[model samples]
Target: MLQKRICIIDDDPIYKLITKKLIQKTKLYSETIEFNNGNEAIIYFEATSDLPDILLLDIEMPEMDGWEFLDEFCKLEKRINKESTVYIASSSIAIEDKLKAKEYKCVKEFLSKPINLDKLQKIAEQN
Candidate 1:
């Protein structure tokens, strides 16, 4: 089995910590990258040639939200690896937010917050 790299883009430190622990339990990813907001992740993406295999994104964040990040990411699509999949991991239960996520081609799925071990394992397997 090939080990994958996962990136988490969110403002919540607690969520990031908990998710990282859950990711460890899955034992599927060799590397995990974290960003406090979409802007930070965008900067990293712009500066680096390497990209994570999977991205877990949050909708609401300081300085560049998920929607804005998606727009910027689309512009970099031609330069970046197409294999990288993005998943919206937000706490929002709004139907509008979910619908908005579907507009982005890079978004694979919209997952609720507090992503469990099983979901992480399933996401890794799918990728």
Candidate 2:
């Protein structure tokens, strides 16, 4: 199987750290790229057209929040980009958050914090 790429965008280092560790344990991807916030990830994607196979984004960030990132990202030349699997990982349980996440077509699903292997496997399948 071809190794998949997964990007993690979160301001929390612990989330990024644990997620990366979990991903490594899965041995499911060639690499897992991480960003402390959404703007950094957006900047990365803008410079590099080779987008990840999947994206794990957090809703809240200091700059370029997840919603903004999604809005700006989808507007980019859709032809030049492949459909990167998106999973919104957040601690927010607000119904509004879930509803807002679905507004973006790129988002495949939303998972609450403390992501586990099961969620990772499911996201892998979605990829």
The best candidate by TM-score is 1
Global CA lDDT of candidate 2, please? 0.85
Note the Cα lDDT for every prediction shown.
0.93, 0.85
TM-score of 2: 0.94
- Residue lDDT tens for model 1, 32-66: 99999999998998898567889999999999999
Q: Give per-model CA RMSD.
A: 0.9, 1.2
Worst 10 residues of 2 by lDDT: 75-84
Estimate the overall C-alpha local distance difference test score of candidate 1. 0.93
**Clashing pairs counted in every model:** 0, 0
In model 1, where do residues sit more than 4 Å from their true spots?
none
Error of 2 at 112 (Å): 0.4
